[model samples]
Target: MKESHKDIWLKRKQLGRSRYLVLFGLLPWGLGLTVITSLIELISFQQINPVWVPARLVLFFFIGFFVANARWQAMENRFESDSQQRP
Candidate 1:
């Protein structure tokens, strides 16, 4: 028998032991943007170029946190809907 969506979500939540998945997703995306900008600066050889590493870090944190919260919310919603649907 096929597993319910709720069961799948529960397993995904419980098995998501490491909190690093959020970082893994956020860092590559943010860092990719940062690196591209930084490279453009290097290629142009601009004096006193500003890449804003701090701002990139903030973006990374925000994205990571948002992703984590979204995952949790999705899981909770799935569980609640499943419970409501059950007889």
Candidate 2:
């Protein structure tokens, strides 16, 4: 059976929300892992570069932002398509 525009839109919206939630939830875990890795390096080597943490954080932030933006764009496209299909 073919799905209606409304149904497609709802599904897309749900997917977009889930992607955003996943991104938000994983961000902290990523940061934690970075910190743990940094600590391990520091402990093992007795000298760790201090610039890695900020660079890692900035990279994480930009990646997350890009993912979130992509999901948002998908949701927006679905919304527009749904609206166009309406009478």
List the global CA lDDT of all models. Answer: 0.63, 0.66
* Separate clash counts for every candidate: 0, 0
Model 2 CA deviation exceeding 4 Å by range = 1-49
User: Tens digit of lDDT per residue, candidate 2, span 1-87?
Assistant: 136755765765676665664555347545755677789988998977988888766676666666666756776786777678877
Please provide, for model 1 over 1-78, each residue's C-alpha lDDT reduced to its tens digit, 9 standing for 90 to 100. Answer: 126765666666675635444544456656765676667767787642555766866686677667766767766776
**Residue 65, candidate 2: alpha-carbon lDDT:** 63
Q: Report the poorest 10 consecutive residues by lDDT, candidate 1.
A: 17-26
